[model samples]
Target: MTLNIVFMGTPDFAVPSLAELLSNGFNVVRVYTQPPRKSGRGQKLAKSPVHQFAELMGVPVETPESFRKPSVIDDLEALNVDVACVVAYGQILPQRALDAPKEGCLNLHGSLLPRWRGAAPIQRAIMSGDEKTGVQIIQMAKGLDTGDILLSETVPIQPTDTAGTLSERMSRTGAGLWPRALAALSRGGLTPTPQEGEPTYAHKIDKAEARLNWTRPAKTLDCHIRGLAPFPGAWCEMDGERLKIHLAEPSQGDGKPGEVLNDALLIACGDGALRLKTVQPAGKPKMSAEDFLRGTPVGKGTILT
Candidate 1:
């Protein structure tokens, strides 16, 4: 039997799970997403990725600012959905709305519970130099990501993995795990287990945090650079201009922190050195270190702050 689903999501990360549910013949009655907000250089209103996808799928969509309103809760209850699936919905759900569905709410969180259990799990995992991270399907509670796990799947953190790449992989993995979770839920066989171990909160990454600290160990700096790549990129100041480091790796070398070691874009850190592979100069497109060097020479012995 097809389960009646009310999907709550907003960003691109949530699109795959919504698509999977529809493709698998689940009866998705309605979608709830965050309202369109001003974005980009023009500051024009922009619809969320999930909102655009939901429109294409011909699903009725609601962009509610909050679920605290009695009418909103009443409307949700009117749908009488069997289950509510939430993925990066960008808002704290109210208990009234959570109780609207017969089976309670389920969330597909980006990280394993009790660890990196907050807004920026994927980025935090890589930034902390974790060896592994995974996704968790949980029975949602009112607390922030404090929920019992219904299902989970681990994914390794590769040496070259960035936040963007890791999030893409996790999205697919979580989408694949959904069918199994729904099957178990339908049969009343899905077990909810309490999350174990000490919890580490994954706070939202600020743009200011992307500034590279040359005083840190090379390996730690490498992780920091990779973790924030492709957005709010890890950057350093050179010739009074910001140079965002898109790719870098720890290498053998030592000198005063932030000192350029060679012509290959190697910069000494507190412990070792970092070999910058790709970079983006302020107001310029990303380019290889070699390409960047050709145009703007950063000779050896130059200090980068």
Candidate 2:
């Protein structure tokens, strides 16, 4: 029997799971996504990717400001959904909404919990230099991502992996995992295991954290830069202008912190040095350090604050 499912999600990361369910013939009764908000330099309203995709698939969509209202819960309850599948929905569900579905809700989380169980798991895992992370399907509860595990699949953390790359990998992994987990739930054989060990919360990344601290070890600095790449990028000042570092490599060299070691843009840190691999200057395209140095002369002892 096809189960009645309600998909809740926002952003491109959540798109695959919804697609997977539809492609596999799950009975998706409705989809919930956040209302579009004004964004961009011009502040024009932009619809979320999930909303656009749902419309294309001809599914009913809901964009309530909050689920705390009784009427919202009443509306959801009237649907008689068997389960809700949530992925990066970006809103906290009210208890009534959580309880509206008969078989409970499940979430596609981007970490191997009980670690990184909060808002910025992918960024936190990369910034903290974690060796591995994964996608997890969990039985949703009241606490933020503090849910019982339904299924998990680990992915290795490559040395060169940035938040962008890791997030992409998790998205694909989530797509593959969701259909099977939902199928098992439909079959009445899915067992959820309680999360084990102390949970480390991945607090949201502040915009201030994007400023690169050359005083840190080269390896740590590399992680910091990579983790924040492609958005609010790890930044430093050079020649009185802010420069964003998108990619870098650990190097064996030393000087005063932020001091350039050679013409290669090997900047000294507290512990070692880092060779700038790729960077984007303000109002400029991302380019290799070699090309950047060639265009703008910077040599030994030139400090990057």
Per-residue C-alpha lDDT of model 1 across residues 149-206, encoded as one tens digit per residue: 9999999999999999999899989988888999999998999999999999999999
What is candidate 1's CA lDDT for residue 144? Answer: 92
What's the C-alpha lDDT at position 189 in model 2? 80
* Candidate 2: residue 30 lDDT (0-100): 96
- The window of 10 residues in a row where model 2 has the poorest summed lDDT is 91-100
Q: Give stretches of model 2 more than 4 Å off.
A: none
Model 1 TM-score?
0.98
Q: Name the best candidate (by TM-score).
A: 1
List lDDT for all candidates, in order: 0.93, 0.91
> Against the true structure, candidate 1 has what lDDT?
0.93
C-alpha TM-scores of all predictions: 0.98, 0.97
Error (Å) of candidate 2 at residue 226 is 1.2
Pairs with backbone N, CA or C atoms under 3 Å apart (clashes), candidate 2: none
- Model 2 over residues 153-198: C-alpha lDDT tens digits? 9998899999988888889898899888988987898988999998
- Write down the lDDT that model 2 would get: 0.91
